[model samples]
Target: MIHVVFEKANVEALRKSFELDPSMDGEIAEVQDDFAVGPLADVDTEEGAAARLQWWKDILAGGHNEGLADDGHVDDQKVVRELKAKLDENPEEIVWIWAAQNKHDVSGYYWLMSQLTEYQGRIYILYLNNLPFINEKGNIFYPTNLFQIQPKEFVKAKKLARVITPSEFEVDPDEWTKLCNEDKGVRQLEGGKKLVSRGYDYYDNELLKFVTKEWQKGNKLLQQYFSKSKEITGDSYLLWRLKYLVEVGKIEMQGDWRNMKDFQVRLPGTNAEAAETTSAEASQS
Candidate 1:
């Protein structure tokens, strides 16, 4: 059996689970790239793929996530091609796709399973949607991502695996195609494999709520937003949007704007000197 997961952290979690139960051991492959956010116009076509890559390039050009390369989606395509080849080489080999309840995992599920329709019966899914699992502390809780589950809990999760039905194989791909054609910047999980499309600035107002009249460091502001906001997105994308907010004069920026830690942001017409003095006093205290 070959296991496919969406997040990189999930790859390690599965490895740990394999160690706990040797019988469930299999090769694990991660589908990189968060399809929850970004342009998905004709993503299956070569021109659309190039356009998507360029979009990522523009987002990363803002100097967020310096470690990530621009060719991740391209690499992911290669990974999928290799997975298909492996399946072709061995008909007995079955695939297991693990996903948890969240737009990131669900969107990735739609993108990946659409490509594996040819392998219909051989592909299985373990969707832990709204399912209760015991964490490290033995508390029962619902998880939003696969990485959040304890390795031991995965042994139980394996029971949730079900073969991709013929109906789903036919319907899910159409859903993906519809999403691609819609060309929306954001795909939100409404519930149970249903996605709602939204514009690129979907999170802009939420981001703005975090911005105050008093200057706040970019990194600190992002931390507060991630901790407080119910809607979560990539920090790189949020940073890019923050810069856009600055460009349009919705927010004021100071210091080196290229790096999050090196810059500070506030609402328009804020007292810069007083803000700096307050920051210095807080640091001294």
Candidate 2:
């Protein structure tokens, strides 16, 4: 059996869960790049691929963004090719794809399924976006992603895996095309309906406020403060916004922005004329 997850956290959690589950034996893999979070362009051609990669680079010009390196650290072509090879090699193996209902997982799920449209092996999906789980306090919660799922609960989800039908492959590919070509944001709703529409960043304002309030305490470690912030979705998106703030004189940081530990942030205009100096520097750059 081969398990595919969209993020490293899910991959690590699933790997740990499988290791602890004496009855389960298999390999786990992660799509290191978060396709749901970045530029959605036609990736079938070299020009489109280059444009997509450039978009990522522009977003991270001020910081070290994940999957932005041209050296192939987060190469989509390499990852997709590897997935194809894996599917080709394991013809009879059961391929389990775990995803959630959120934009990130759903988009990733769609992109990945599109890649496997021609695959002849068995494929199963455990989409837990709407599934309820009992928490330690006996409270029911519907987690948005596999990272939030308890290790023991994973085994339960395995039983609910549904086989991907041929018709599903046909229908989903069409939806993926719209999602890639259109400006509409990719969304997978209940019953597997893919909806594309204009989307907004729901976390931006809340995260900005959080950063402003936290700066009152003193200079902050970028990753540490963000880890404490519950509203933000992921590090990449948060850092991208943080870089914008740095440019607009809202946050101040020095050194390599990619190394969150080495970087620091404080409220703008709090230190003499630093905000003005920073803005001038940003403009010059």
Top candidate by TM-score: 1
| Model 2 regions more than 4 Å off | 19-23, 64-68, 136-139, 184-203, 211-231, 245-285
Error of 1 at 9 (Å): 0.9
Residue 97 CA error for candidate 2 (Å)? 0.6
If scored against the real structure, what TM-score would every candidate get?
Answer: 0.92, 0.73
User: What is the per-residue lDDT of model 2 for residues 1-285, given as tens digits with 9 covering 90 to 100?
Assistant: 778888878887787677667565687767765565555667667887787677667666655554465667776577677767877887776678888777677777777788788773477888885789766677889887788877778877778788888998988878877777774332334344455544434445655665542233222543445567654455656677777777877767655666666565667656457768899999999
lDDT (Cα, tens digit) per residue for candidate 1, span 1-285 = 999999889999888998888988999998888899998988877888778777888887857565365545446788789899999999899999999889999989999999888998999999988999998888999998888988899988999999999999999999998988887799899878899899999999999999999989999999999999999899888988988999999999888757888999999867876789899999999
RMSD of 1: 5.0
* Regions more than 4 Å wrong, model 1: 71-74, 272-285
TM-score of 1: 0.92
Local distance difference test values of all predictions, in order: 0.88, 0.68
Pull out the clashing pairs in model 1. Answer: none
Model 1 CA lDDT for position 237:
88
